[model samples]
Target: MKANETIIVEEQLSAPISVVWDAITNLNSMKKWFFNNIPSFKSEVGFKTQFNVKSEERNFLHLWEIIEVVPSKKIVYNWKYAEYSGNSLVYFELFENINNTTKIKLTCKITESFSDDIPEFKTESCRGGWNYFIKQNLKNYLENS
Candidate 1:
């Protein structure tokens, strides 16, 4: 895949950078809005975890390995599926905006393309998923709790 094939999702949250950082880095906090089934997660490089996500009656075993971390600022992970051939780098960056709000930029870079036969692996689908998670789910979670 090309470097420009990355899907970026940005959101301005009505919370401090610290709160947003905690929500993204803390395993327990992530389960509330990120992925409910994430068995374990750590903001340290080389840490790895796996979890399952079901969609359209298909189950995807998500394999994640932390590649880089800058506390309260950025985290990057290698994201792939156990049953798929493709791999991607997912980045979560937090910026401190005015008024204590946080600007979160999520970049999903497709390092390798998965099977095109699967709709879930399409770029549009990936973009939509990030939009839903960042703009809707995470926004609601941060604003309400």
Candidate 2:
């Protein structure tokens, strides 16, 4: 984040680490909340996966290559769009509280061409979007299911 150019949004959800981890790692569970057209997905390291993300009128075709996976703890992947040439990294960290609840933290760092594009590739937008999806939608899906 450069000076006042980027926005950082952080959210904490109350759920067991196992449940949250499963929701993220399991392709079936992830599609329910995150992607509407996730034809294929995997959490295995070195695996390449493709998933579709649609929000209302806009559609996004996401291609990701799993870079790292630590069972029951963390997973990191490179996120890139088929239409876009640049790539970013998405990281998921799972922490366990004393009450058996999990504190899941999602950190996304933009490292490609988009980072240089000021108003177009707004960092605040990415932060807010990630916060909403992980804190609100993902929590609801994992807790209610």
| Cα lDDT computed for each candidate against the true fold | 0.92, 0.73
Off by over 4 Å in 1: 1-4
Tens digit per residue, CA lDDT, model 2, 11-108: 45566788888888888888788875677777899888786666565445788888999988889988777764456778888888877777777877
**What is candidate 1's lDDT per residue for 1-145, written digit by digit as tens?**
3334788999999999999999999999899999998999889999999999998888899999999999999999999998878989999999999999999999999888778888998878889999999999899999889
Once model 1 is optimally superposed onto the true structure by TM-score, how far is the C-alpha of residue 93 displaced, in angstroms?
Answer: 0.6
Best-fitting candidate, measured by TM-score?
Answer: 1
TM-score of each: 0.95, 0.82
